[model samples]
Target: MKKFLATLTASSMLLLAACGQEGEKSGASTSGGGGGSGDKVIEVWHIETGEREKYFENVATQFEKANPGTDIKLLRIPNDAFKQKLSVAMSGGNPPDVFQSWGGGWLKNFVEQGSVTDITEQVDAAQFHKNAIANTTFDDKVYGVPLGISTNLVFYNKEIFAKYNLEEPKTWDEFVNVIETLKKNDIIPLSLANKTKWPGAYYLMDITSRLAGPELFESAFKRTGRGFDDPAYVEAGKYIQDLVKMDAFNPGFNGLPYDEGGSRQLLYTGQAAMINTTNSFINNIRAEAPEFEEKLGFFPFPSLPGGKGEMTHVPANTGPVFSVSTKAEEPKLAAEFLNLMTTKENAQIYTDTTGSLTAVNDAAPNDETMKPIYDYLATATHMQMPYDQTLPPELAEVHKDTTQALFGLSMTPEEAAKQMEAKAKEMLDK
Candidate 1:
């Protein structure tokens, strides 16, 4: 999941409380046939705050203005609390009419539980990129509309790299050399905030893919010929531990919070030379310190010698997708609202404001800073969703926890691999 809010303000807390009360009142009528009412209320839940929240609110307002007698109730939830709240609502048989989704195993679970609406007939899948559409589709059925696309890569300080006479590394060995050089110079080679656990999982995910390829990971995830205990996974874990042992990351990174400016702050101060984070980091820097924009540089995760994965393989996926509830009182109306949210105009607004790429094929970032990302994504052969979002909820939590354990040196790479394999068997075997 993406952390949009660094810290929940008092007003946000109040909004959550109010939304909770509204959700209780609206849960009973979440789903049914459309057009049988005098006034319609579509309760929409999302984890967008700040300017993005304003954009959603503006869209809702526009929707209401265009469609009289229809009220769009917007619930802005904190990112950390969103999953728990949504899960509670879903399990209680009162999911919101439309809610934010990451649209992979996360959305797949909801579809399996019969909590998500099948929007195959309602949404025009061709309007979005195929990779973005893939995340929202299950069994050839469309269930959600993608809002944007996101990919993770290394963001380095160009000034620092120049000072050390280092260029972007294309191979794993060269990448390691760069990190070692940065560490030797008394700089944090990598800025990481693993207090939330998901940040560190990226390393394992990317390294495993680079070493053994996405096919192996997918096969292991599907419990086919491969398993999580494969050498690729263990090696990935070992790679992370090796970095930890070498003091590659900042001190106390395990306890730091990414949303609270933990890693980005280091980058801003030139104390950390690099951070492997999603493209949203560009928007974050633009928002926090526009002056540092020129100092920023990006590169994809380095390839491994003899590895099955190619350089074009990337850890990427659609940003938050929107799915309607299976039980929505006005499914068609909700679908129409989703359409309104994803219109070309709105998508352009989203791209312009967020400094990110919208899922809409026609909407792209105009900023030069995002051009490299756009270009890289254009040629990406394999876009991998984050492991936490790709795995079932229980398994996802275990992956994150064990990955964190690796960062903390509390578990050996082999032990972590075995632990993941055991969980996979326990979850998938059933």
Candidate 2:
């Protein structure tokens, strides 16, 4: 099964590479001069492509205009290649001035190694969401500026809910009732694309939040407790299997590809009642089925009965953070660019283009369809970063692989927990 998954991923990457080659200048490119006239060239690296890349370029152009004698060199890399390239550059003492980061253990490693600079004074923490700032901060010092916030929740079709007389569920039991009702009505209860694995992992993330609360995961991440072997972790896997047993996901869900619109297609056509995904999904729905946007309703993950997790706790994280390298030629200019990029005006430009949640305070998109997300965030008691981002890379991969296997019914919940614990222990012991 692992070999099969590897083949699938490689094939996908090959196809992506082919597409990227055809659109050479668009998806990835480097822009800047060699060196001349004592000009300060601040190199910036990012993984966003298409309109997102364009947005960053426009902002860079704006910053250059605002600050003469400093060239903001932009290097756009494909997501698959960006991380490796950045790691190599950083380790080789030639890192970019600013680069994309998903803050957590990943950023902490750079922080501890002194590859990234501490920008505590340059940033005003109060200008961003607490969760965003927290994600980028380490040891009481800020290392990066958050670009956006992402929350995973159940997005439902309002028309389907109204037809079935279902209200937004507050508890796990009520959530199950909605699922059963949808299934009885011959509608797919949920739309999922597990081909990439991470989409399916969201289920385990939300369930774990409900079953064990944030402290258990944090303690485990900090290497203080049972780690992934905790009973709560096992129980979260059981809930995922429970959903699988109930036929909660669409047919061929495990085989579907998210980037290819397999799952969003189901919801757009009303074949599925709901989809568990993040704010990034909004762009897909709008592009595929613009008319259906009005029917989309966002709700927080329902709480579990007698659970230690707060109902207000959410599985969320800020999107890619922009961090300056400690080895930059012009650290001050790079720092200034970071500030320029995160200003309310520029942040809103990102929110407007992507329909995603921005990290800048009061910068949430004003679209009515996105209002529910903001409303939920306003009262959220906690923001649990996605496990794949918060956990060490090796353990994170194990989490994804095990959760996918659980979804496929190839492994029991307890077995999945044991596998995760074993991997966590092996990695930490090394």
Tens digit per residue, CA lDDT, model 1, 307-335 = 89988888996767999998799999999
Residue 340 CA displacement from its true place in model 2, Å: 0.3
- 322 in model 1: Cα distance from truth in Å? 0.5
Model 1 regions more than 4 Å off: 1-38
The lowest-lDDT stretch of 10 consecutive residues in candidate 1 is 28-37
lDDT for each candidate structure: 0.87, 0.83
Instruction: Say which candidate scores most in TM-score.
Output: 1
**Model 2 pairs whose backbones collide:** none
lDDT of 2 by residue, 1-430 (tens): 9999999999999999889655743555776533222377787888765556767778878877777777777888866567677887778786878888889877877888899988998878889988888888988999999987888889999999999999999899999999999999999999999988889999998988888888888887778855887989888888898999999998778888777788998888899999999877786665667788888887888998878998788888776699988998777788888898889988888888767778899887777876677778778888888888877777888989999999999999899989988888887766
TM-score of 1: 0.89
